[model samples]
Target: MICNVFTQSIKRKYLVLAFVLVCGLTIMVSYYKPISHRYMFLPDTQVANLNFYDQNVISGFVFGKGTPMAVSCPLLLSGNKQEMLVAQSFKRTTRIPSFYYSYLAKNCSLFKSRRNYITSSLTLEEEQFPIAYSMVVYKDVEQVERLLRSIYRPQNIYCVHLDNKSEPEFRETLTEITNCFQNVFVSKESLDVRWGTMSVLEADLICMHELWKYKSWKYFINLTGQEFPLKTNAEIVGILKNLNGKNNIRKSVLNRWATRWEKAGKAPAGIIPVKGDLQIAVNREFVDYVLHNKTAKKFLKWCSKTKVPDETFFVSLHYNKHLKIGGSYTDDQGNSTDPPYITRFKTWEGTAKPCHGKYVRRVCVYGVGDLPLLINRKELFVNKLHLDFEPLALDCLEETLYNVTRNEYFQTLEGNGPPKHT
Candidate 1:
């Protein structure tokens, strides 16, 4: 009887051990099952243990056919450390002011300062570098030279796409200079053919789509070549179109910047810049509203079929959405004081371009063209400021914009996010 009881206990112990092993195996299979099949192009994401599916390989594809292969998996945004992607359109600023590197070195993220800063473009190498998506179109040799001196640096990740129509020699010359810059990336695009509203907008969208590949940024800002940054206030107020968040600056956006235009015998309606107004700084959602959303696309398509009027394109959508976006172009006193965007405009010299060379000396305006400022009373962005006027632009950036960017970085660190405007 004693032997029988002992044998029974041993048998039960063995059975329990077997069960535990099987359970462990099952868990392991569940954990790594996703790794079995490979995904060729995984979209930028912030998830671990991602799901995987098998590859399909039937015959050649036909029109309207075999379910277009899914390219992107559902993105899981990382709420932990949000970042921004600044899409800057630049020709080159090598001849610009002296303090460019000084500004970035002092204020921009210094991942290199810490041990083990991965400089490689591939993998999770970079710590917190903001991806600067720069579209390069028709930069004079002088401008390109100036850029090498001023803004081109390792910290900046540039998606520098030049127009395809540019002379090969120009590309060759630019590439030589670009090669000198350690982190400068060169890209070419076949988009020179279209300068219309849809074309320009499409290129802008294309730049964003390409930019999305490099960095995982929370917001993307469209920057111009001539545009300078005067101030970047850290304390941003959300113009919450998402009203539950407490910001509603969307009320101020004015849609009709123009009066009715007479179509001049097949010459596409010519609409002048609204006195002093230019483009807007709408949010990512609003941007997508015009670019991707179905209803918005339909509206844009209808517009494209006609004059493809840019004025109505943005304004109409903002009106259609009945949405309020957020961004502050003002200072504490409600003064328009974004530093980089601010400038001391001299009287316009006689030239085809709005901004000719550079202001050699500060003179009061008695001119053909006047300096333009945004509706918020803030200066929109300057044109014509170049290597010649580098000192002034540099001073403006150092004293004003750089400080704001620094503060903004800290504010982000401290948990307050980006500022908003209409």
Candidate 2:
């Protein structure tokens, strides 16, 4: 009877072991199972991961009917010691600026020192294209200063448009900051920018007109104060050179919602209305035509009466055949073809929403976990970075873009054969 009991106990042990192994296998399979399969194309995302799917297939697996296929997965970062340090620095800077700006304003030398510390670390590259930038900013003075530092190059020019509605202290701080940099200037004509109004377009138009005075800039890129450059100025110069005079603008269909301007009797005939975001990069010739051409002026006037002229003005200018500049690459449908759309990376409302960061007013505020994704992206600039939401994101970008150690990282990628320039 004792022997029988021992055999039964041994059998029970084996049964328990088998059950644990089966449970482990089940858990592993569940972890990796395809959560969902859906079409994705993140035109505004930092990385355009569209190479995986073909535009001709219908299976949506090995084949798909899309220009590019992008399947997004969850992204999360493990907070390391260094990342925490950067986060701490961001907190300190954001807090102290508000409290100390009054005293700093009275003391010029101290103010200069603080400004120098941020700008001095950046090293501009040689043989770089003279890029022109117009950044429209309202609040977030500290954030804008950080962005300027990251993208500052002696060769390029910057036009900053501070909203006329901004507080006096914000205006004073921006003036003091720009006073130190010769290439940087505060737009003399500051517009009171509003959502869904022509004023937004007017602010950019004012900057473009100002930037046009200097004939040296090769390409005109627009920015809001929240954007930061992912690629160095040197890398961007290489991209523009290869483009050979092509512009990067996002194109979209103008449906009923887009036709609001037309319904309101703001759109004009002989001008085909297209839709795109205000963020874009255009050549000097394009800028001149938009500012001076009679046709463009009439279109502008009509658009000013529209709901959101910013979206219509540039798209119309780009596709307008009357301009006689065949700069825009049109598809078979006669729309702008796979334009590089690289001036700024953004996350909009859709299936591929950013799972790794917080969203404010329906826009993703990128964080450190999103760094790997941003770095891998082909775009030169990424936008809407608020220090309050994700300080480490900007901090890591500074460390990677400006720090000496980054040279090695760049060298390796180049040595391994850098991806074709965007």
Candidate 3:
């Protein structure tokens, strides 16, 4: 009887140990899963195994069209009014903190596994001709990370300039994330970027200086944290190749305040100050000229004393034929009308189609309703997505891009053809 009692006690102990092990696993799973996944409507099992390259998984859940279509579609894309309301009610409950990135950095393989960062050049053209990006970011670390991930290509180089006034945690998280990539780095010199100020131009200059070290890059594109790409890397390379050597700098009619530069005597003599967008896609030669040319240096220095120097500096250099900056537009284009450029697509308040998303500071913060238009835009990138206001907008855009990229990559591998560049 004593022997039988001992045997029963052993079985009881084994059951208790098994229960503890199961509880431990549940806790670990909850703790390790990213907060972003919690907002996804997919079942935990499907989301846990989600893979962009898996055709079976992507065709169903990723594209939002499969069995149980209502649940499969991203909440924002659902036609049901109730689902739309549910998405509207969903808010980012927590900021992705520094520790999260720190953990990822420690486990680099796990970091790469969690997100679909294209680690290889998908095409020969992309590998042969790499692009450089300058990102000036201040707030919204999560948005910054997502933007980086969406545009990330191993062949490309990235220089991120963080605002000096940003939170320490923001800096820490960015540093950790950038540390994972060889080509990506945070600018050593941080500036306090303010709107309508020379600091904006200065931030880009700092990145340009650093990016100049990467001799292999063919073109330089400046971006902000809120923007996301509309084209894949291969598509972007094809477009840049078509440009041959010309720059894509938007030139607009001079602002009424242009006289202020002349009044202050800050304008270089005989050099006309013009207004244009801060975002630009200039060739390596243009970037080199801006970094080292004596005339460009003088123009930039003079611009410092003027209001909103960013709106004038690059455009002025490109328009002034006398400067002879490589890849610049020699003709006086922006004296009367805004010249067209395909570098970025932004919806300003009171212009073009009505903003489906709400306006903040006169810029449209894109919502899910804007996805159709965004997908159709030919611009390389689209500007200003607010994670808090409409996270699904970004989520859907990102998923679509991922699927497109995967399909293009596989098609090329099958000897079909290169990605079609519009």
Q: What TM-score would every model get versus the actual structure? A: 0.41, 0.70, 0.81
lDDT of 3 by residue, 43-113 (tens): 55543443332334324423234422223234445445566665555664434545555556655677765
The per-model lDDT (C-alpha) reads: 0.36, 0.66, 0.78
Model 3 bad stretches (over 4 Å): 1-96, 259-262, 333-339
| Of candidates 3 and 1, the better by lDDT | 3
The digit string of per-residue lDDT tens for model 2 on 121-146 reads 22332324688999999987767876
TM-score of predicted structure 2: 0.70
Candidate 2 lDDT for residue 371: 74
Candidate 3 TM-score to native: 0.81
Q: Candidate 2, clashing residue pairs? A: none
Report the error of model 3 at residue 163, Å: 1.2
lDDT of 2: 0.66
C-alpha root-mean-square deviation, each candidate? 22.3, 19.9, 6.1
Clash count list over all predictions = 27, 0, 0
Task: Provide the global lDDT of candidate 3 against the true structure.
Answer: 0.78
Q: After superposition, how far is residue 415 of candidate 1 from its true place, in Å?
A: 16
The weakest ten consecutive residues by lDDT in model 3 span: 63-72
